[model samples]
Structures are given as structure tokens and as C-alpha cells.
Target: MLKEKGLFGNIGVQVVIAMCVGTLVGAMMGQSASMFAPLGSIFIHLIKMLVIPLVAVAIISGAAGLGSSQSAGKVGLSTLGFFGLTSAVAVALALFMGVVFQPGVGVDMTGVEGMFSNVYADKGEMPTFWATVLGMIPTNVFQSLNEANILQILVFCLFFGIAVSKLEKERRDPLINGVNAIVDAMVWMINVVMKVAPLGVFGLMADAVGTFGFSALMVVFKLFVVYVVAILIYGFIFYPAMIKAFSKTSPLKFLSAMKKPQAVALSTASSMATLPVTMEVCEEELGVKNSTASFVLPLGATINMSGNAIYYGLVAIFFAQMFNVELGMGAYIAIIVTSTLGAVGQAGVPGPSFLVVAVLLAAGIPIEGLPLLFALDRIFDMIRTALNITGDAACAVIVDNMINDGPQETPEPESSHHA
Candidate 1:
């Protein structure tokens, strides 16, 4: 019977059926359905465990490869330029979406202030953006590997790769080749692990549905609308226009190629896990150099979180309003700057955003309002991850174009025979 239906096809069919069954069971039994909840929670935890390592290894390896390429300088400049341009566009689209959709316009969050009391607080010691930059250099880079100090790891890898690039050809090629093989192996392992994704999704959904009950969907709806609008604006209007304005490639064509990776990102709700696919799409379909695309997209996964930044801005505003904490012009400016900088250093974990939100709340607003955000986080995360991957691809394409268009020095031919 299993062989009669294709494995993936059967799994997909099962998920649809399970969702329908879960919906019916939920509507009938309400929160009394306890069986699937624990199983689902475990599944979510397992997936979350993979995120930090996946990001650290992928970025370190990708950066090392990028640094080795002949066009390293051109690639680096283009990547930075692309990140700057796309990030600016993302912020603009987020602001526009907030105004146009007004997601928080009607939600009565009078009780939300009380919720913030349960949120975590930093004891007068949160690092400044510059301090955080310096902290990336771990006291012991190897010991801190699991903790995922990505910036430090990246810094170390960059210098190491550059040094390798300058080595004698015989020595350098073997080392680079070995590392490349390891990266390829890791990527292959991740793809294998992803085969169990439907089970994970089912587990997570079952748990959320069982515990939260149907009424929690109202919060989900609000976040869903905001997230969908934000993603559409960022992926469609913002990135496409930039591609057309900056690159030789057609924006529509580029977007079409990105669809598979975007879908994977949304499903996995992780930018890091989706990095390999993002790199592949950019290099193959978007015409980004493999070395450049590999490096920039991985780093972008770690640092260029435009979606999370938008979420930071919106959530800070939302919770403040919910708590009836009036912030003047000065406070809003502080939120924007701190949130944007903080997001770059954010870890790719399920609830990492909450920590940032908690910091903002601790600054003066109410942290208790975070429970409301938590209730809607999964829905929002799906969209946020998708938006993040889109920015990664856009950065790669623009960077590729810039490098190709830059000045070129023709190389002289070698003589057929030595004198």
C-alpha cells in the first residue's frame, strides 16, 4: 500500500488529512485533546536544536570559500552593496505595510501590560552594538563553537582563508579541497534530515492546536495578516524593483527561481537551514558567482535579518501601546536604532526575538506584554523566515551584477616557449 503511493505524495496527503482531523477533533474536544501535545513539543525542540550549528558551520565554510576566490574583493564589495540596498528597501516596505495594513489598529490589548511582568529582564548590563561586535571574538573560539558566536567564527575564518589563498598552490589546493568536501557532506546530511519535516510539522501543529485552543487564533490572525503583507511587500515590490534598478537580470525571472527556497524557508521557519538552497538558487538561476553567493547568503542568514528587524519595530510599538506606555519621539528613535542593530546579532532560535523584545521592554516599557507576542510567534516566524531568504537572494544577485560590471584588467598571454 505504501509503495502504491509515492513516499512524499503519501506524506503530504497524510499531513492534509491529519490537519483536517486535528481541526475537527479540536472543534469537538476543545483543549481536552492531550495526546499529541507532548509529541509535538518534542518535535519542535528537535528541529530547534539543529538551527544554531547549521548556521555557524555553513557561514564559516561559505566565508572561507568566498575569501579564496580570484574575485574576492569584487565579491565582497558587491555583497556589502547588495545588503545595504536591500536592507534599506526592506525597512521602507515594512513601514509602508504597517501604515497600509494597520494590524494593531483594532486589537484591544488592555490586559497586555500585566503580561509583561512575567518577561525576562537584564540587570543593567546589555551590551552596546559596538561591544557586541567586539564580543564576537570569543575568549576561546573552539570552546565557544557550540554557543555560536557567529561573528567571531566568521572573523577567524576570513583571516584563515585569506592566509590560505596566499599560500603556495600545492599546499593551498589540498586544504581548501578538504574543507569544501566537509561542507558538501554537511549540506547532504541536512537534506537527509529534512525528509522528516512533515512529521515535525505535524507534531508542532498538533501541540499548538491542542494547547492554545481555538480562541488563540485571533492573535494568530492579526500576526498572520501583518506577516503576509510584510513578506509580500519585501519579496515582491522591494526586492524586484531593486533587481530591475540595479542588475541586468529581470526581476520576475529572479523571483521565480527563488520560489523553491522561499517555500523551504517558510516551511522550516529557519533562515539558516534554508541557506544551502538559497545559495544554490542564487548561483545557478540568478547568475551569482558560486563563491560570492555561497559567502554572502550564509552571512546574510546570520546578520541581514530584515524581517526580524521589522518585527522588532512593530512588536516594540505594539507592546508599548498595549501597556499604555507613552513614548515620545525620542523613544521611537531609540527603538528603531537598537532593534536594527540588535537583530544583526540575533541567534537563529525559536524564541530569540523574545529576548530582544524583552530588552526593549526592560528599557522602560512593560515586558509583560510579551505573552501576547509569544502566542503569535510561530505564525509570524514563518513569514519572517521567508522574507529573510528573499533578502539573501536579492543581495546575491545585486552583488553578482556589481562585480561583473566593475572594471577589468586584461591578462597578457604567456609565451609558448621559455627564453
Candidate 2:
């Protein structure tokens, strides 16, 4: 008999089954499925509750930690450069695929008209470049957090972290420890929240499938296919090639060892949750030194989001097509820039489906379309989280190579050393 993977061991399988069952019930029950919407809402609210504290603490701690070390500056610069380059590539690739596939070309918007009417009613024109730039700097940090203005929070945190990093060790240690404590608490809260994810996902899927039926999914089916294809290319082709080029480690072996963490990321749909496993795989299985893996992987989990960049680009273009919004070259350029920035700024924020609002605002796309995207966000989240962790591991390998002059030899087994 095949061994059962148990509840947590088979979470990905459970979620997939939940999605299918939700779709079936929704399709049969029609409008009645809307009742389950509250379950999803509560889940989203729980996620949102953790977002501000978690993001602020993670970013602040990560930035301050980097500033504390000497050679870390070099590592930080290298990591950022790698992240920027990879994110740019991911977004550009997404845009290319979106244009080629034209997934939103024939989507029927009649069903969602009522849902978005209020949003479109108050839709203002896109802000100018300078205005957008000025807006990122918060006039009142408290007000920014209250309003959940992520860009402003990001800006404030960057400066605050730098200031903290410059403080004397005696002063800095207390603050760092305090922030670390807060992060730990927030993560614990997230774990508590995630126990309800299957129910939440079921409700979300039920409502979406009931309201629009399979027809809505059909409209965006091409977009989904294109995204999956793009991610697979990144995961299987791009990552392996990058690893081979930068390090002497066998890409196949690296991927084999990464299976556990990747599974965790896929199931949990949270990079922060998968960080410990990623660190273990990088150090023990992939032969990276503790110093390099420790610094690079955690930072990558927070800011290096190749997957979100791609999703943002594709979603921006998809919505632009859906709404028949004509985007100029300037608008497309803005999409690339803002999407990249938003991915970094919005890291660790739950319910990222809505975080695309920042990109839409920048690209002049209607925020009204967000509700439509939110319906299918859970499905996309699983795939992107997997890609995100894959990118993190690839980065650790590359950074290790740069710092240590190619892959270090795997350490001798403990038992053999003792013998």
C-alpha cells in the first residue's frame, strides 16, 4: 500500500481538490454560492491584519542587518543587482507573452459591470510622473500606515532602517531584537491564519465559479496558460542555465535538493514560511556556506520577487486589453518600472491580488478590474510562490559563486569525519 502523506504533508493536493470541488458546487448552486464569500473575506482580512507589521519588520530588520556587516555591502549590492536584472527579465517576458497570447481579447465584461460600477464612478485620471514620485514620500508615516499606502511605507522603512543601522551597537541591538520579536509574532499569527486557507480558497473559488461560471475562466484561460508556460521556462530553463553559468554545481542536483522547499512554497504560498527550508537546502544540500546562504536567502525572500514582477506585467496588460484601454509606449514603460518597484515594495503583503492596484494606478488601467482578478488570485498565488522560491535558491547559488569563487565542495559527512 502506498504511504499516505497525511494532512499537512498533502496540503497542495488538498488545495487542488478543494478548488475542483468548489468549482463544481458553485456551478451547480449558482447565485447561492455567494453565501460562502464571507469565508474568503475573513481569510483575506486575517492576512491583511498581518501585512503591515510583518512587512515593516522584515524590511527594517533585513536592511539594518545588511548595513551592520562590512563585506555585506558588496553582497547586498550584488544581490540587488541580480534581483533587478531578473525581475526586469521576468516582467519583459510576461509582457511579450501577454501581447502574443492576447488573453483578454474576447472577455465579456457584462457580468462584472455591476461589481465594478462604483469603482469606475470615482476613477480619477492617472497621476503624473512627478506627482507619483512625490507621493511615495509620506507626509505622515502614521497616516500612510493607516491608509495602507505601501509605497510610502516602503520609503519610510528604507530610511528608518538605514538610520537604525548607523546607531551604536548597544542601541541597535535592542531595536533589532525588538523588531525580530515582532516579526516572529506576526509569522506565528500567519500560521494560525493559514489553517483556514483551504476553506477560504474554497469559498473564493465557489463564488467566482458560480458568479461567472466557466465562461469567465475561459476568457482568461490563455493568460493563465501563458503565465504557467513563462514560469516553467524560468524555473526549468532560465534558473538552471544561470546556475550552470555562475557556479560549478550541477544544476540537476541543485533542483533535486530543492524539491522539498519548493513543495513547501507551493503548498503554503508564502515565501516567508519556506525560508527555513530554503536556507537548509542551500547550505546542506547545495554546498553553500552558512554566511552566504544566511544573508542572501532571507533578503531574497523579502525583496527578490521575480514571480510577482511577471504576474504584475501580465495582469496589467491583460486588464488593459479587457477594458479596451489604449496604452501608449510611455504607459508600457511605466508598467515595467512600476511593476518592478511594486513587487519589491509589496513583498510579504498578503492578498497581493490587490497590490496590483499600484501597477494599475501607474499604467492608467482602471482599478475597477481588481475585483475580477481577486476572484482567481488564490490559484495564481500557489504558482508564483513556487517560482519566487526557485528564484531565491538560484540567487543563493549565484551569490555564493561570486563570493567564494564557484561552488564549494560538499562538506564531509559528520559520521565519516568522526570515524
Candidate 3:
């Protein structure tokens, strides 16, 4: 199901080609390549169009069905706790590596001085972590839908789905069937939109490269290299180890099964845009039950950001090293806490990350040189989104495996997927 027949039909190959060509074109044309940004925007918008509805439908269907599980509450809590734990681990790793490697030491600040700004400082004070958690509840669900507040949508759908589950069997079955049919419809729409992924990826790469260029990277090439290594360590090492330790699934098999969704994540750079594909691969390819895939994947796509956690931790260390500021024990704790929670608070949408600002301030690091990283965030976003989806899949696989071992009245959470 993940494969395409001919060479040209392979969307993954096509996306890679587009990414390369777009980077080349951007380098050649410079800021003029900004014209292609609309192409990327259109694709993202198309994907966004389906995300809210797909999430709602899938969660409703999954939760309603999972309502039958004796340990359903345990399943949901475990998934949340797993993400938070992994993110915390990842940030701790990043901080350790940053301190050991010191990629930010002896940096030139000549050109970096001009790009620094305080405008983004206000972004840090927007919402405390508790406030963001509280805000997940929808005051008006219709308003939540209109605003596309995913967390609120998730909460509302769970309440609605559980209420439906409590209804008479005759009533519940019909509504579940209806919601699932809509799930299939949304999946089809995502498929249609994905055909143009190459065009959209090209635009995104061009705009990001054209505007940012590689000049800014020269000063921080060492940091970029270290950043990539940290990402690879988490993506390949930590995640695979988790799969090996916790699930019957092979690490190689789980990684190979992840290719299609990872490609989409790379091209689109939005975990929300890639959710449908993630759900599909999780259920069909990895043998994750439909219910586990639905609930865990959607929640993971929204909040699980181990990669971002790594980035935040490293960046905080990067700045501290660059300034020769000694980070005390308290600073390290602050970095870990802030980065882990900040990454968790991140929305799945692909955009320049402002959460890094909050991490820096919380740890008392200066935020002066952040614009350089902001320019490079698109590339970073692509990489991290892949990690996010991988985490989503890992959680689903492990959680599904755990549920299978538990006491259950109904073994199957739903009918066969893609039926």
C-alpha cells in the first residue's frame, strides 16, 4: 500500500527531486524564489482542510470503540506519560551533548549581532504550561472547529464519543459507522491532495532557502552538524531501542514501515498534515489496532515532540556556550523542564518555532542570535516532523501491544481498517 508502481509515480522520489531542485533554484535566484511560496502554502492549506475533520472522526470512532476496553483509561494515560518521558529524555541528551561538544563556543558575533531582536521576547510570556493545558478544553466547540484548535477538538470529540458509547447499542453502532465512513472520505481527500506534494515541497524549500540562504549557516555549521547528529541519535537510537524493549515488533521492521509517512512529513513539515498517513501506516503496516492508532496517533501528532525538545535543549546550550555563561545545576534543570514542556506544548503545524524563545528566557540565556536559527527552521521542521510521527507510531505500536496483553471483553477495537 505504501508503494507506487513506476519510478515517476513514486511520490517519495518525486518529493526528493523537488526538494533538491528547489534548493538549487533558491540558491540561484535568492529572494526572488519567494514567488514559489504560494505553492507550498496551497498544499499545506489543502492538508489542513482535512486535518480537523479527520482527527475528530477518527478520535470519535476510536474512543467510542475503546470505551469498551476495561483498561481504556490506562491506555490514554500511558500514551501521554510515554511522550512526556521520551521528550524529557531527549532534551536531557541534547543538553549533555551540547555541553560536551560546545558547538557554540568561540563563535563570531559580528554578523550575528545585526540579526538579533527583542520583538520575539513577547512570545515567551503568551501562556504558562498550565494555562495551555487548561485551554485544551473548548468553551465553544463550534468555535474550536472554526479556529481549528486541535487540543480542544480532541477533548470535545472524546466527550462526545464517550457519551455516544454510553447510548443504547442500537444507537451507538449506527453513529460509529457513520463517523468511520467520514474517516474513509477524509482519507481519500488526503490522498488526492498528496498528489501535488512535490510541487508544494518545491515551493517550501525555495522560499525557505531563497529568503534565508546558506550564509547564516556558515557561522553555525558546526551547530547545525551537531543538531543533525542529535536528531539522528534520538530518531534511530532512542526510538528503536524503545520499540525493541517494549514491543514484539522488530526495530528494523518498525523503521521500514515508517518510510511513507516520514516522506510525507519531510515534504509537508506538518505533523497534522501527515496524521492520516501516520494513522494508515500504524494500523495497516505495523499491525496497530485501529483504536490505538486513532487515539494515540492524533494525540501524539498534537503534542509529542521529542525532536523539538532536543532542538530547544541544544539551542539553549548553544547560546550559553557562545556567551561563555556558566550554566549552573539550576540552569540545566530549567533547560530540561522548559524544553520538554515547551516541545510538548508545540502545535503540530509547520511554521517558524517561537517556543525556543521561551526556553532560552526560562533558563536565563540571551535570545539575541535566534534569527539565524529561525531562518533555518524550515529545514529543522522537516527533520523534526519526521521524528514526531515516528514517535506517534512507536507509541501506537507499543500501546497496542500492551492492550493486547491486558484483560479485554472485545479483542478487536474496530473492523478492519481501510474497509
Best by TM-score: 3
* Clash totals in order: 5, 0, 0
Report the Cα lDDT for candidate 2: 0.72
Write the residue-wise lDDT of candidate 3 on 151-231 in tens digits: 899899988888877788777788888988898888888888988999999999999889888887777887888888998
Off by over 4 Å in 1: 1-61, 69-71, 92-102, 109-116, 123-126, 409-419
Candidate 2 TM-score versus the reference: 0.71
Question: lDDT of model 3 at residue 106?
Answer: 86
lDDT of 1 at 109: 49
TM-score of each: 0.83, 0.71, 0.96
| Candidate 2 Cα outliers beyond 4 Å, as residue runs | 1-10, 98-133, 247-305, 311-382, 385-389, 400-419
Q: Compared with the true structure, what per-residue lDDT tens digits does model 1 show for residues 186-274?
A: 66666555556555555555555665665666643564577677778777887789889988989889889877777667655778767
lDDT against the true structure, per candidate, is 0.63, 0.72, 0.86
Worst 10 residues of 1 by lDDT: 410-419
Q: Clash pairs of candidate 1?
A: 115-368, 116-367, 116-368, 116-369, 117-368
